[model samples]
Target: MTDLTGTSFEFPGEYYEIMRKDFRNLDAETEFLASLLPDAGTVLDLGCGTGSNLRALRERGHRGTGVDQSAAFLEYARAAGDEGISYVEARAEEYRTDERYDLVYSLFMTLNYLDRGRLPAVLRSVRELLNPGGQVVLEFGHLLNFVDSFQPNSVGHHRRDGVLITRLARQFINAHAANWRNEETLLVRTADGTVAMYDNFFDQAVLTGPEVRELLAAAGLTITAEYGGFRKEPAPFHGRGPLVIVATATPADTASDTAQQEENQA
Candidate 1:
């Protein structure tokens, strides 16, 4: 039996029996982040699937490392043969690094994968690994994107990098319990006529806006700004699409501490 369960069609990898489509609009996505991080020197990407964002950053001369839990994704990232960049196969909640970065980001609601109980620890770890005056960007748009957007069962497909991908998605919402369960079946086909299929289950934490703010504050991080989309525009009261958040450590001595650490390392 073919082990298709390990493959994801949304972020395709080389190991999948059938070619899959990678994430969409990667160039635009990375460019939007670049505008926000004009002077960023070092970057750490948490939950970086398939290394697309890291690859985009490296192309523009930013030193970057990607961390994710998928071996298949990491293998695909390493296969890109980019020596200047690195990939770590580890869970975002459990991973640690000695190096601090000028920017630490988790995109596409990656934080939702971690239990709410673990979010504070993740933030603390992010705080400890940030350089002075650095920033952390988190996009929790999934929370909003999924609202009123799911139909009973829907199928869609697109072609990218020569791979064709078809996905069937369904949602079961429990409003009383604040539970949103999504199940997706991906059918991938290579240009060479090979085919593969896999099922993915995503059950995420549905948090209120105020609850998120309190959680960030409790974690010693402050929300600097929130955007409605990639444009960096102010989020509307009842707007749709993804919501992005920019944050930083709340301590006053973080800059000095970072300077001291850099000097000691030097």
Candidate 2:
């Protein structure tokens, strides 16, 4: 998430490989998003690890840029030399672009990597990077994802691309915001029977639906849709799965209205 600032942990060399191998939702995610894009639209994937989503978009006659903090992930993506997909290595919160995109998305709860203090910057950045009427699709784990959904401790196995991985995940919820932090240990067995392991750690803020909408409004963005899962259904009052938000840059009139309301409050 934040490059382990004020923290100590070794980043796994094969982190991206384990993620690509274990998490099996990239295709489904791209298909869900493809149905929502405008014709020939461009996308910018914040925290686009390994550029898998962008690859899927390219096959559908669309192109985009992928930005991430990991050089290894970006290099792996660039090796494809796919003209349709470009990448940059930068932290999501500090990165900016002069060119705007028709669709800007951060999937797999990448935004959660930014702690509460820095989320506003990302919201503003999304606002600036989006064209008028363009939408930003953000998916992130919610407090309920841990509180009501995932178990406190669990293990799973994945076998793909000639690698066998066993993941043991432990989650802890902070008392106040109910923010969820995860420490995952991966045991990877290579085809040659080499065994390696590493610990992956990250935390997500427990910002609720109201906080998200308010932050978007403050950033001159309007929420067009919010959901609990990938199926595009409305999120329950509290529930499992991520809180997926689809928002657009507010038009001039809506911006004016929001300013007026702020002034009135003052």
Candidate 3:
């Protein structure tokens, strides 16, 4: 098992489209996220894989830059020829830019790939990159989802353009910590009857609702809303769906005053 700690799991760039095709409702998700911003808003996509969401958002009249650590994914995204979308290869925690954005979003449990030590830095970077009153949206697996509905093993098969791909997944949860491990094997068969196999594994941290709120607050962000899914349903403290968090930077003066109070108390 290849340990994928603090990195995006390795997946064949060419197979990304096929693997992710039915995994998400791209149109609905784009509409949901776009409704949060003004017309023609500038956006930043953190951990943007293959720039799919960025492309969809671009089509909705929004221009954005995508940041991902995978060169292969970035290369594939750039080849799409989207006029206003730009790709940057960088990890979420280390990515910085002089251009502030009206909205910054990281989706599909991207932040979970980071452990507790790195998550704060990533959140702070996100806060610094947002414009005044700008929003940050994140989608991640919550503790409840993992604890209550985790499936240990699953298999999926997808075929596209004369290629057949089969994915087998196994999950292991840490009983003592807010983390889990996933092992995956991919089998690909091409039109010429050549077969290839790949095996890898990754770890993810699962934070509870309160833990997530606390982390965001400590990063100088205030949670504006939470949803259970893309449909904008109220987020339950315990559930089986991913948590969609919408937050904005706390007022500078307010954050400063709070920090001062904490120091004085200490």
Error of 1 at 231 (Å): 1.8
Worst 10 residues of 3 by lDDT: 1-10
Give the whole-model CA lDDT for all candidates, comma-separated. 0.72, 0.77, 0.85
What would the TM-scores of all predictions be?
Answer: 0.81, 0.88, 0.91
Ranking by lDDT: 3, 2, 1
Off by over 4 Å in 2: 1-22, 176-178
The backbone clash count of each candidate, in order, is: 0, 0, 0
Worst 10 residues of 1 by lDDT: 1-10
Candidate 2 all-Cα RMSD: 3.1
Candidate 3, 195-257: lDDT as tens digits: 998776778887777888888998999998889888888877668788999999999899999
lDDT tens digits by residue: candidate 1, 27-72: 6678876765655378899988778788888877787788888777
What are the C-alpha RMSDs, in order, of all predicted structures?
Answer: 7.3, 3.1, 2.3
Question: Best candidate per lDDT, number?
Answer: 3
Better of 1 and 3 by TM-score: 3
Task: Report how far residue 241 has shifted in candidate 2, in Å.
Answer: 0.8
Please tell me which model should have the higher TM-score, number 1 or number 2.
2
